[model samples]
Target: MQTLLKPSFTRETAFLKVKAAEDAWNRRSAILNQTLNTKMVRV
Candidate 1:
């Protein structure tokens, strides 16, 4: 979005932000999946 418009804007910090966001999302999804699996096993 904004990054596409501002091609020169995404260098180091922007890259780090995007990477951190992606990693956080993946971790969150993995945690949720694990919780669901644990609940299923308990049942």
Candidate 2:
């Protein structure tokens, strides 16, 4: 909720938030892909 209630004060802040989210998502997908590959290798 804080994000819902408070608007970003600058374009830079919004851009930073978007970039961080994208980075985190990319990292998560990469980790998941790696785990899946490892499991497949073991099988």
TM-score for each model: 0.52, 0.56
lDDT (Cα) of model 2: 0.79
Per-model lDDT:
0.78, 0.79
What is the C-alpha RMSD, rounded to one decimal, of candidate 2? Answer: 7.9
* Candidate 2 local lDDT, 1-43, one digit each (tens): 3545656467898899899999999999987778533755454
- Segments in model 1 whose C-alpha atoms lie over 4 Å from true places: 1-10, 36-43
Predictions: Cα RMSD each: 7.5, 7.9
Q: Write the per-residue lDDT of candidate 1 for residues 1-43, one digit (tens) a residue.
A: 3544556555898899899999999999987777533755453
The superposed Cα distance between candidate 2 and the true structure at residue 14, in angstroms, equals: 0.3
